[model samples]
Target: MILIEDTVISDDVADKFFVCNLEKCKGACCVEGDLGAPLEASELPVLDEIFPKIKPYLTPEGIKAIEEKGCYEQDWEGDYVTPTIEGRECAYALYDERGVLKCGIEQAYNDGVVDFKKPISCHLYPIRITKYEHYHALNYDRWHICSPACDLGKNLGVPVYKFLKDPLIRAFGDDWYKQLEREIEEK
Candidate 1:
């Protein structure tokens, strides 16, 4: 799948350091964009095998994304929403903990689809690291209800080097990442 290139992008991963005060914001993250984070081409087969039986039950966009293995099939600048699961109008159409719409994939996993797991990007939140100049930097992109888990500074006090590298390895793999590692490290 082709990654929708974002030239102007967030420097750090948005990790939820604390369980976001989501109730206050009411699951704003779910409405923000595609709920699932980036997935590797290698991971396509897993969903292909599972989505068919459940395809009709999924939202039209969700089904299309599964087929393409591309999350943002269209440019989701904003203004998108899903039909209420039980009864409510959430853009992403996920359940609310009392009120706020939660991630659709997470809720789907709870309903069933036991094999469902978070994408590598989702697992590593607010602590996102990307190649910036000669070095890597940690960024707190969405501090609000978007990614409350991103503020790891409290426990870790800071996002250490390994935190950045491990996820990069998972996202890009050993060889591709090694190139990036060399680019940043050796210079």
Candidate 2:
């Protein structure tokens, strides 16, 4: 494990390589999870506030799910998450012409309808964060659906941490990401 400030990061992040192969996986991560994208407490209001802006980009089923279940729901684990369409794709997911799942929230953000991108959890995929009383534990989530990504990453020689630099900085801040880089370099 590598320690940076209050977070303990698993070495797999540096050892493994990954870059989402959306063409191959078709964004299965958005559709195959047991639950919708995880949400932080602070993100609830943001979801509520941005739903209207993102709604236009959603499918009818997605809009219906959100309309009936609200923007988010609490799972059996008592953790908040985005709503799903019939326990399938995330309510915020939209498919492109090729049927690849894309984030409606991200589309809206790119269109300048909202400032917030998708959830930090979704943005930082393959990296799951668990918060303990004293520190946050960061681990790489290995999923078979992402095998193409693993192949691509290895071919390109991009470590998981390096591939995820932008979202890591977004989640942990520039200083924290810089410290993480330094620590990895020293390794």
Instruction: Indicate which candidate wins on TM-score.
Output: 2
Superposed model 2: Cα runs more than 4 Å off:
none
* Pairs of residues at least 3 apart in sequence or in different chains that clash in candidate 2: none
The lDDT values for all models are 0.43, 0.95
Q: Residue by residue across 20-68, what tens digits does model 1's lDDT show?
A: 4455657555454433344444544554455554444456554544445
Candidate 1 has its poorest 10 consecutive residues by lDDT at 1-10
- RMSD of each candidate relative to the true structure: 8.5, 0.6
Report the lDDT of model 2 for residue 93: 95
Among all windows of 10 consecutive residues in model 2, the one with the lowest summed lDDT is 48-57
**Candidate 2 TM-score over all chains jointly:** 0.99
